[model samples]
Target: MSELLQLIKQAAMEQVESSKPVAVMIGKVVSAAPLEIQLDQKLRLTEEFLVLTKAVVDYSINMTVDHTTESHTHSHSYQDDSTSRTTQPHTHNHAYVGTKSFTIHNKLKVDDHVILLRVQGGQEYIVLDVVGGGIL
Candidate 1:
């Protein structure tokens, strides 16, 4: 029946409108502390609704330096009954142990453009990375 087909179509449309799987959007950071991002003129997301990635957050790492070789050249004078002098080059192998810290990323700032992934159900957005001319 025509009415039955129309009903099915209307129900399908309603279901599509109500279900949100995922969405990608571009947003501009409006505030840093207690971050705020503006998706549009009418929609702005705050920290509570956002999840940040390592690329947009201040991240640090520690590294270790191990065994290494060092070379040095020096002259040694040896005086024998014959009075002779000699110079030699020496190579030294040393075990080096040290910790190095590295900063992988910097936090986002106001006016920065970023890419965001809208999580399913549309309740939260994950900040993937900073884009354009920004700290990224």
Candidate 2:
């Protein structure tokens, strides 16, 4: 019985080793071609067949006053006014600044650089980080 078990284990190991070369070949085939071509060929489809009809939407970074801070942090709010005719009201708030209002005690100064990240939904642009205090 022990000898039979050993033989079975050896056969399993050999099978795994023999498939390594085939796996490597498949990897080479996949990496040799561009992703778009490979997907089209593999799925037997064309780009136009899978084309999306949704309208392309674009976002732009905008700056506004920080009116919700009282100490060291600043805050700003953004609203999308593009689809005002639609039923959905698109608006969001972001507290990028740490204080409730911008004050002289904080690191932020008037005309300082504020980074706004264009995000999808909820808070569109959040304060990533603050820079440029020496200008003031």
Best prediction by lDDT: 1
Candidate 2 Cα deviation (angstroms), residue 40: 41
TM-score of each: 0.62, 0.18
Roughly what TM-score does model 2 have, to 2 decimal places?
0.18
Model 2 Cα lDDT, one tens digit per residue, 90-119: 355455543333223332233333333323
Stretches > 4 Å off in candidate 2: 1-107, 121-123, 134-136
lDDT of 1 by residue, 23-129 (tens): 99999999999899999999999999999988889988998877665765656788878989776755556666799787876798999999999987688999998
Model 2 per-residue lDDT at 25: 9
Residue ranges of candidate 1 with Cα displaced over 4 Å: 1-18, 66-97
